[model samples]
Target: MRIKRLVQKHPEEKTFWKNDQWFNVYVQVNEEKRPDYKSRLYGEFDRFGFEAEDKYASLAEDDEHNGWRLFRRFKMVLHNNKRLTKDVTVKDFCGKQMTAFPLFVMSIKYLREHLLQAVTTQKIGIEETDILYVLTVPAIWDDNAKRFMRDAAVDADIDPARLKLALEPECASIWCETLGTDVKGAVAIAGSQYMVVDLGGGTADVSVHERKPDGSLKEIMKASGGPWGGIFVDENYMKLLDRLYGEEALTDLRKTEMSDYFDIIREFEHKKRTVDIKNTKHVIVRLSVSLRDLANKYSKQSLEERIAALDSHKNAITPKGKDKLKVDWTVIQSWFKIPIDLLIQHIKTLLAEPKMKRVQTVILVGGFGESQYVQDRIRKEIPDDLKYTYGTNVFQYFDENKYPDDKKVWENGKWQVPFCFKVYVRVNEQVKVDQQMTKRSTPNSKISLTAVYRTTQEHPKYITDPGCELLGTIELENSTDIPFEQQRLETTFMFGDTELFVKTKNKTTGKEAYMTFECFT
Candidate 1:
């Protein structure tokens, strides 16, 4: 009943249909001495909640109770970069140990239930049967790794037929097709060849695609990527923190004061997006109060004293109060250089390949793609002819101009009117009439006619007089074959005819309308 009401409210719903919706599931091991495994669900869901909480919590937990014991990264690396062996064991947040394969299966099951609950609450009528579960893996993952992921999804209660393992870069490429020309820039148009650079927290995946005539895409190059991504940048930042305050102190802070550790990284992530390489100003890095106190207890001097010494050596460290350090722009740039340089080199290798020679655009997508520093570096270092664009820009462009008037038939009334038309009629017979009735007696009473005669003869007209008798009227019926849903009828005036004719055309059923009229005397 609700769906019926929705359809009535939005009569255009009949035009849109989709067989399935896909959700991307990413798995990782929590940060611990023996790390626990966790997973995050992406695509068409509350990504903000995932980012804030850092992990998928139970569906019943309130917002405040979530995100505790959340490990920010994963360490479940496959042996030989392939399948997971039977010996792989990981700890959960409960400190209980389980094999990596089972952990993945459990995480996926949680994600599945959460998504199903969401769909049920929304009353979208999307059952588990309608969903196609797609798990995205780094391009570096081999066939065995893909198989392991597929098996895990099946173990999570997803049908084997419904589960699919997708390469990250390829998935990003497919996503790019849904983006607009503005966000994607000029390169997103059909027939243009481009590469998708998916830079996420843990890995960077790259692949090339050529837009097809039908708006679909075809892969032109094999997927390629590495572990060089946002996580590496975070790692580099952590190394800097280790240098500022003793590494042991930082480690202690991570173990004993994880909330503060998460805060520090969260601040760094915010600054990383706004960091400008062209600006040579001092960038401030805030240290957690707990971290500063721990560093002071373990170091040779107070944290401030060490910062002063570093500043004297042009290391550009300035202690701001007891909890913040002012870092030189050059130092911050150095931290970005490691990951940016690696990403550039990887892109260079991709560009140099024979298959990639024709790539005209480079699309930067995913979490790390939001980094202004990363975007600036790639834009500058890459060849000038090859345009480098971000994923968000593409979506923005399309969102603004999603429905142009020319593409909408209903908006332009293309369906209601005939595309083009011709008129033809045969004269049935001529009858004798009274001479007085034939003559135009009164200017007001005479009907004016405009006619284009096919033969070199004058056209005749009917005269109305007091002596004229009324004849029976004939009405024409609309065609039954026309799809009433897609079209409507209109009355139009024509020249050279006194009779009214009806015509109907079915755009959906491809049925033509025949014009017929009856004459009465």
Candidate 2:
């Protein structure tokens, strides 16, 4: 007998909503409480609308941190008036039954508007012409994902054309580049060879890179992803709580007084992210309050007596959100063993493979990579002979894709050099070249200087394309010759390797050109 499972097709261009105005939109969704949160919440996003601001706020903080003084103010407003939920929602604000997406979208919308304001004033780093990259989960990808992205992008004042949506796996490559690790043919070097394991709340992604002598690095990025990271552990903690306190107890608390239950759960999550012990104690109290309130409503016991009973079972009622936590450390360690073991097994297999046996080091990165438990487990599993490095703040380099050849050189020195020099372009043989192209230009028009391109000997690895050399920038000796609008020097560096032609345009509009002597390897 043959069996069939359901499959969904990805959405095409119509997935995005359109208006008369032009805008670039980029959106990515992840599971709110899980890795698959964004997928489950897609339909709801249509009814409630996307909020780019909240997503930005959520991203700014690790988790549980609502942004800053602004967040505190918003929290107060939401707390004082539950009707604020109704204001934000198109439908009735049903307590406990309320979905997480609406709030998430609202937050994103708020954050994006704030960011837009700053951008208008030229306060933020994100420029009007910059393309926005929205991070999302791998599970809920398809037409729905595209729609959500476009919705969010439009709200963020970004043009949909300029917006690029990518999964975390693909973003890992960008992260490497943002950190100045992206290079061509870099895997051959010793210091440059290492795996980038991005273990975050909902997923874990891995990539490998090698450094090149020309100050660049190359990466071995994987294509597959799965549900393996922090959210699963959080679910485990929830299950444990349900087992001890009785699921009914939580149901009652959420139904009658959701804020109370949400407060406790939210605080517990905050503690987990912060690793704060005092917060853990508060979680115990919060849970105890719920238990006491439920007991008071059902039994003849006094609130004080119910509270006492809760304290007694506190050992069994584990708090995962905001507290130092009450669960056995050994149990927590064992709970994570499954995913940890999987990672270890994969690493072991990769190392055992004949091609990877020579590998000497591993680099740990991402949100979950910061977990003390994960670090300890990796340390205990790997051989002492192999080296390890942790990317303490990988998010800081999340946007890095343009990598120089040398990591050490880029990290240590901030020297300016003429990058346009040695840059080269190959014009199509069929393409016409005007030898006196500059002569036709106006007096204030830009002209190309003597281009200095990389020699085959200087970048041997890049010799795959023999004619592809580095191209240089044009220089105007006379200051008055440069016009205000023409101050920008634009040149297209052409390159081709028989099959296809490639061109890289360099626009030096406002920044001064760097002067440095050329060096050969």
Candidate 3:
């Protein structure tokens, strides 16, 4: 009936889909503690969510030597490397190797099993069949990446029929619109148009939605945004530390005193949230003695000495007492600048579009969206007017002037419209999963079918047109006993999938054959 928000301790680590509607996931890949911090598909590790993040960060040094790696952000697994197809095969901590697919399977299985157990225990009073599981994914993720998640979910034993995929920002818009009427800024009413910006740890996703008169929401703009999220701010913090302590010292800290290393970032994360335009006071962050001692050991200088020796940040950063650092509000705000600027730039671009002219409200959701600085920056830069597709299969935004009007069939009274098939479809623009059209043609005893062309091209409207290439063919056989006109060759064209299917049958003989052609994205 309604989405139930399951409160969790780690709000920052919670994935968008976990708002309890549908869920989406990303994984951290494990492997060599490479200096580059890029992820790799790993074996023998299944720690998930924020817990996975902490585990991966904690095991940074341990995994390099032992080969045991923990990972997160698995949802973007396909985005990082162009060559990786499905699950990648790599060695685990124990030196035993397997595909990353199993790790995802194991994680989803944990959730699926937990939910089923809850149902069995009466925690949830509903039939197993009544449950519809949704997996949320980024609008930027390619079809392969989305499919990779789908396959993982299917392998996890979540029934495919009950599973659906949602775009991160789109669903956030849905959640915002569905908020109770008593809530402030509640605009779920019909004709309300709003822009939803979902700023997660890895990326800032943007989308626009309008509530239709029928109580359903329609997207007015495609999803767009970039890697301007909380993690980048964290990276900026790390970079600052790298400058102060030197790379060697920070590496040593991560390897030797990992918890202290995590503590430093955690403290900064807290500071990042609290420091804003109104809070002009210097923020205090406690420094572990190990970090101070390590700084001395690695750089032959204490952190205090390093802070005093700084060039530009010299006055802004201060070594307070012995075990703490006092940072000027300006210095702290710089860490948020890059991400906020990037996010604002994107939001501005989306709002500037003519099609987005009617959108009046902007909804903010996601962990990074909690930042007062981020919120302020958006309001300051864009002033008013704020923004902002589907999970991939690379979609090209065709210019309105470039293509002919959408597919239409002249039928009874106004086009008996868009009752076609598809997971997502636009009004006046229908894409069927498998719409079959039957045409009857009289033929003799046999009909020769010569061609099956696999072309990515969508136009030309005929087989004789350019862009068609020969693939394979099949012939249909008929019974000679049937009347000439009655010996019908029934041809059916199915346009439900990425590939086009043609099914043929001989009316008199009951003989059948089919051919498939790949559709160009």
Candidate 4:
């Protein structure tokens, strides 16, 4: 298939609406009703949208959280711990809490319920298994992370067979397929290659794709990204607050009026994105009255005096009328500098690769991608090789072609299914990458089930043998409504990279379905 499958995800907004109205994912659990964030009691959760995300600080400091601690950025376990087993219990950063898993389950359930509710409201009947629930994750996430996400979906009452984990950057680019090549100085169209930089809240996923002659985009370079996201800017802004507000006062406010504290931060959040590269005027932000009062109570100094005490060349933060603070453009720019620098550096290295050389348009997509400051910095800092205007003009979308380089070896179209089922890798098997991915193709009258197994004994004959254990199943259904002769399944088992990507296309319908298989080695 020339183009990858077009699964979907969020665009460059708090929640970009796919079908008319936006379905928000920022879930705010009613901590008042349930003190436990890890409660498995699904469908009882509250709103999860921008308002909930903005209220995260407040939720973290609720009175009920006195004994337990709140954890953020809990997704890093997959990357940090390479020895992590699928069944191993995941703990918090301090290795104490078992809360992240259940939290994930709750979030997934809430999302599913909301989606179902939206459909039901329109008087539409949808089967749970027939509807493939797509969950987009950072491309930097490895196999373990993918497994964790899949397990969470399973726990959320979703069938793993119907679940599809879409890479975040690919989701962004695939969503842009309809962004026709009508823009000025356009290079992205049918057959041209481009790069997708998905800058989300905490991670930036980068990938390159080429539009095939059949209108399907093929992945040239797999996923490469880092933790250089927009949240880093928010962190720097917090550091600035700690320095200016006095850590004691800030800490006290976080303990007492966290909602106000979050609002204070969100005030800067709103202002930061608006400040552009050419912005020369001071960005004005309305300060929370509680913050200003607490600053004086704890610091024993007024806001004006604190500004005066700074030894810098110019005052980055200035006191405006009563509660408003006029922040310098320089300060906002500095907050954006480090993360954007790291992100651009990563892009430069990605572009330097042989396969990546043909990439012309660098489409920036995500919530962070909406930042005028981030976009402006990318335009100025990155090399001229990325000349096309990102996020503004070039947004292409389509089905994502993952593991595009996995070549399928078909032998004379004679017999592949019968042999594939009987194929075996000896215990302590030592075979090349090419051998593992090779499989023959033939039309089947019925669906085929390719079961993967792991055995303890060196020579185990059947799955019912003493040491053999069923690990996973890869199923191939007819690609489209077609005759047995018109169907062809391009099956491949890619190992060593830690997963299996199976591609099948119906010759008559020209439809393709991707199946990913994950199992214990």
Candidate 5:
């Protein structure tokens, strides 16, 4: 209902996924009130978790506050894999069999409930029918993947007619259109070609577009991307830690201190965004007590001893405090290398293509696009002539053209004949001529007329209907004010279920003539 009220208040605004993260839902709001629609609700994808039947059953007995295990990163995996069909079941953390389709449906339902609750709390007035949903998918997703998403939405009660699919980069391009000249400046100029780099949490999508004179975009090349994203960076970091602490120790820490592990990753995300590989001397990451103890036990060395042994020309890692560790620039750079290298390679491949040769600017957007290291790597690796800009939000550029209403405008009316016609005449001192034409038709019959003109020379003047589908011409014997020999007029007519008439008048003599025609199907 809130979605409906929002639609009623601002019909142009539609609901959309903020990004591939799937952690938040962004609803477009009226631009007059808030230029940026930061309005978001929590996504329910991670809310449902698997637990032992006995534990879940006992928890269900309470009917509230039941513990649910959290499932994360599965959305990306499911979307990327072709073998994971709607009917295939996956094991959750608790080893419960859950179909991927229902998980998506549950997520959609959670989103809908949150939207409705927001509307109710805000006291907006409307109904379910007024809301339209737009889902954004990676441009690289094939038709089957897109269809699966649509089917999930439909199974969740989203109307098929009201649902729309959009490409992530194109959505970012639309948002770029809303940027002010003071911000985007000449890059927003019409006819400029831009490569939209959507570096989100799970993937880095790239697309090229040329801005049209009308402010719309023409896609110059197909979109391309890979699994290299912020998540991969996090995974690489985790792998590094696993190597240093031993896989068993890290696994134990994850099982025993899941919250602390999440916090550690979250801190890495912040550092990943702010870390300056060019100037920063060192980067510090917080470590939990359990993790530190486990690492020391598995490696048979004190945390400080390990740091001293691993120190090298590139950089060094040392214990910052009881709960933190300092990593030198070299170590941090190595962690960023995996994803950043992939990203740079992707951009190079795109730029090397003949179609992308003329593209001078690259517009970076999405979560990972906000990384300074990523941006710096691009600047260093890309051609000097190429330009790139970064922004956190660019969804406003996504436009959805919905289907038009099918209502008719005119009412049935009785058949009534209107008389109208056209005529042509020529006058000279020696001769005068006049022509008139008319058509007779029945209700069930069709009529067509054709006329030909013959002359010694071609006619310079001709007339045609508004659609230019029918024409008439007049010819004379010679190019003279007064015809010396013969004059002819030719006309052609084709009629269908409508009636038509033409009228012509002689301005000098104030004489008028008429012609009529009809058609039936």
Candidate 6:
């Protein structure tokens, strides 16, 4: 049977999941006005126990009187397992004794960046109904972080109930649920566990589950995270480069002369996170010249010789335009090997416990997890009895074309490997119902056919005679082609019980505006 899925518009704002291969739709009310950015950050700060400087009468008075002054410089919220309660008497303008709650804000940049991502995602959708998911560390629990998430829901035009804020660990749990696997513990580890490790950036998070008689998995332990990740290693490498190049010389080079040159270096580092690199030589040379130029006052090394060395050292790293820049993993490994060895030791310690040993599988997750060097190292170091799993490695069940020779087998169109789950996504119907059913925004949607599919396992046995059918992935296109002053779209993919929604919105009036939908099954 031929089926077409029309996610009319604003797929960016919706969430998706795959079930008996049918689409379940949910709509979001995209807000018309931009929220007061400062207020939202204030809400987060307040939640984190960072009190306004207004707590001090003089500072409070100054801020109130000075309209243009941004009174708060930085704010942070930290979670503590301890409880402290204190009340202080302060005199108000009315000359009455008032009690004030003392508070402090945590200035952690990482936490601040996350709050910004959530806020930006809420405001900048190309479509009104775009869906976004933000990742967070599991154990770094803080009340203010939760408050920021709550504020995001309040600021959004869509039904606040539809927006979700998940601990990185919990998202992993949801992924496990999506995969339809109960193997949280032994013999097989699934996608969610791996996602947590990735979110953590470096730490290998392990979750154990019990396979029930009906074949569902239960939580063993959520997973642990550490500050050790590839980014941290990158910083270490930057420091090493500075030391090797001579620190003082590098700093002088960065400050005075060619500033844009250093920016390119950071760009290269950012590109490295996305793919593998086998070399970094020539790029380093260009950066070296830029740095030297920046130090216009001094010439430590003759420019010609330095440039020559840099060009000659083609062994530094290889750049692949955008996808990836290559760097010698061997050199990087040599510098970081001791720390990597130390990290492996810690992982081994956790895994060596009797309960951990019962873990059937170990999964590599995060950007670093994708590193060919790391993978090779882990495989070489691991005992023969242990094995690793990657999401990219498990594609055989879903797309045979991608893995034409995938050894994994499906019985009756069902994966024997277990953990196979469904995905579902939802977005709003084109029509809007305020107090009365009406068109709030111009109907901006398109309709098209894309080969879509869902596994038949989640289907009810009584409803249809079923084994497994390749329910083609429904590509959404609006048939009416209703034009909105602002065009937006949301697409959802439901995998098992959980839903992932992506949404994008664009101003139709903008000079450069065109709509296109790229759907993948």
TM-score of every model?
0.58, 0.44, 0.60, 0.60, 0.58, 0.39
Candidate that would win on lDDT: 3
Candidate 1 global TM-score: 0.58
**Model 3 per-residue lDDT tens digits across residues 224-341:** 7777778878887787777777888777876777668767877887777766557467888876777777777778776767778777788888877656878787876887888888
Q: What C-alpha lDDT, on a 0 to 100 scale, does residue 267 get in candidate 1?
A: 92
lDDT of 5 by residue, 164-237 (tens): 99889888877876786632643467877878889888887888988788877788998888777788778877
**Better candidate by lDDT, 1 or 6:** 1
Predicted candidate 2 versus true structure: per-residue lDDT over 177-200, tens digit per residue: 555332322334445555656676
- Over 302-409, each residue of candidate 1 has an lDDT whose tens digit, in order, gives 766665665343457777887887888777777668777888998888877877656766789988888877886776576533111000000011121443433223
Q: Give the per-residue lDDT of model 4 (tens digit) for 1-521.
A: 00011112334213233422223343333223422323322112343545444444445556532223333455665655666654344443123434345556666887898888887787666666558889988899888788888988998989888889989887777778666553212334676788888988788899888877776768888888888888888887777666667888777776777677667877776766665556466678776777777788887777777777776623677777667877777777777788888898888788777776666567788888889878866755554431110000011121135212222233345311121122334433433322344444555555645556555555443355464555555555664355676556554554422344555454455555555555322
Cα-based lDDT at residue 187, candidate 3: 53
Task: Tell me the lDDT of model 1 at 144.
Answer: 74
TM-score of 6: 0.39
Candidate 4 has what TM-score?
A: 0.60
Q: Give me the overall lDDT of model 6.
A: 0.37
**What C-alpha lDDT, on a 0 to 100 scale, does residue 378 get in candidate 2?**
68
Higher-TM-score candidate among 1 and 3? 3
Q: In model 6, which regions exceed 4 Å deviation?
A: 1-136, 140-165, 173-196, 199-206, 210-217, 244-263, 266-288, 302-330, 384-521
Q: How accurate is candidate 4 locally (lDDT)?
A: 0.60
